[model samples]
Target: MGAVTRLFELAAGADRLGLAVTRIGLVVVLVWIGGLKVYHYEADGIAPFVANSPVMSFFYADPANYKAHMNPEGAVVPANRAWHEMNRTYPFALGLGSVIVLYGLLIALHPVLPQAATVGSFLVAVMSVVTLSFLVTTPECWVPDRGGPEHGFPLLSGAGRLVVKDAIMAGAALVTMADSAKAFLRRRARRTPAEVPSAGAVAA
Candidate 1:
């Protein structure tokens, strides 16, 4: 084959490997972030998000009172700790982390359980949607209105930047889901007969 032809051939055939790498990236992100959710600091950091979420505010004991009892990362305040305990922040973080780890493991087992991996991929996409919604629901995502010209809808804060990354995660999950679904269909095709007897053939 010509050198150019060979290059094209290699690129064309690398789709599977590319997806495998994407799967690895997804697993690493899910597991690493999920594991972090178990820490007190991590739970405290998410307080603003959960407190502001329309769907998730119920997770806090008093979402309206969250700001007054906020704990800065790594800071130990007895009153804030007690409030968080009452709010179930630590317990919720642990549970969320466990689910994330489980999702990563499911994706990792694709070689043996593509079905589970497909489900996990779907969940990942759904979760990413929820994460992205924070940009709309959480005020912390936008620069605060501190009398600065750079504080408004188009101005994203650090939390906003982080939430925006979920769009990429959602896309990756969809690509993996599509690949898994194709594999499932191919397997099903193999299990069925190669051909069914036609009505004309039976009549003949």
Candidate 2:
């Protein structure tokens, strides 16, 4: 069969549409989280959601300042109290957020849809790992006060729901990755014998 025909055949059978749908969904999630980060930086409303607790305080404090330091240029800025807090606990959020945005745009616009999805899936897998780790470490909600008369203990609570959600997100990412990988390998397999030249030809 012709190369173009074979290429189409290889790509035609896999769940490309499903992959695209999930990829777009993943992008939406990324964009949401990215916006959250931006809000934490720019708006003060996010403070209450994460205020006065050791676990989530940094989330409320100067979010923009926090995000600013995460950029490549922001790397050199001396670490202060806010940067130290968020960077220490949720260190991957900034880089992962930026990557997600880029991946989303590429998948949405790239001419090579298959390749974009494949690469985007891999990046989403990385994000899933980070999300899973956060789910493991932090509780969803803590007592607003550190040392109230009711119970002075540094209570950690509500981690279960967040964990479940994050687990779902991670699973979605894994499925997306698997679908993309299958598409890639199927395309590779459809290559003609001449396309898979000997090692000598590859070297030459």
Candidate 3:
């Protein structure tokens, strides 16, 4: 029983390091995935999600027409590629990727710049919220009925499974934000001067 309690204490002691590692892990995910968006296949892969999003559709020249030009992963359909070029799909993806990478880098400075990490973690949380909405707004998140009884609600397609994992990131972002905010306050407090009680207050 004493040894078990010691193990629990050890885990508690490592919590701060765990949070720091988690921040780095999230940075790795954002940088790698965001960097991939600059590639043809990666940009093409995200079209369905972007086109289906009402909030994002404005970036495309003709969001409604995207379905007809849908290309599978690594597919090199000239016609579809041309259509995407017209829609500025690649450009939009590149810009979004830059923003994602920037956020990751901002969070990476958590140790010395808690203020930046707070802002970055907040942005990540907002981004995750938008991503999670894809499950509702994007039909492709669920398996389409091709005469299969296992299609639709409660049945996640591969994309849906991937999007759902953003929930963890969202939660982690909040945790990181809170930690950074607390750290910022601690720094501020250290720099602040202590208040001295007036004589009347001291007498009370």
Candidate 4:
């Protein structure tokens, strides 16, 4: 084959590997971030996002007290600790971590259990969309200080940058889902028999 033809062949052959790698990369991200959520600091950092979310705010025991315990100024007082405990942040984080870990594991098992992987991919896609929505729902996504150079509607804060990255994850999940679904259909096709030609037609 010509070099160009050989390159095209190689690219075609790499599709499965590329999908596998994408799945693995997503698994790593989910597990790593989910694991971090189990810690106090990580959970605390996400408090603003969760609190501002109408769908998720109910998870906290005292959503209104989120800022009180955050101690944004780095002052660790009794009130801070009390508010953190009262908010039930740890339990919520743990629950979210558990679900994310499960999703990662399911995606990792795609080779053996593609159906589960498809389900996991679907869940990841949903989660990604929800995370991306934080950019719109959370005021903290944009710089708060009008005096700062970066402060503006178009200028994203650190949290906004983090949320924006979820767009890639959402795209990845969609690709993985499509790949898994194709595999599922192919598997089903193999299990069913194709129709045989009639004897009269074969004679012709």
Give all TM-scores, in the order shown: 0.88, 0.48, 0.93, 0.85
**TM-score-best of 3 and 4:** 3
- In model 2, the Cα lDDT at residue 7 comes to 91
lDDT of 4 at 149: 67
Put down candidate 2 lDDT per residue, 1-204, tens digits, no spaces. Answer: 699999987788666676667667877876776655533232222232333334555544353343334423223334543453544323433544566577666544433465676677667666556545543343333333546554212444454334346566667667776666676677767874555688998899
Per-residue error at 26 for model 3, in Å? 1.4
lDDT (tens digit, per residue) of candidate 3 on 7-68: 99999999989998888888999898999989988888889899999899899999998889
The digit string of per-residue lDDT tens for model 4 on 79-101 reads 77677778888789899988998
The TM-score of predicted model 2 comes to 0.48
lDDT of each: 0.89, 0.53, 0.92, 0.85
Candidate 2 global CA lDDT score: 0.53
Clashing pairs in 4: none
Q: How close is candidate 4 to the true structure, as a TM-score?
A: 0.85
> What value does the lDDT take at residue 108 in candidate 3?
88
Greater-TM-score candidate between 2 and 4: 4
Give residue 20's error in model 2 in angstroms.
4.4
Cα lDDT of model 4 overall? 0.85
Cα lDDT for residue 5, candidate 1: 100
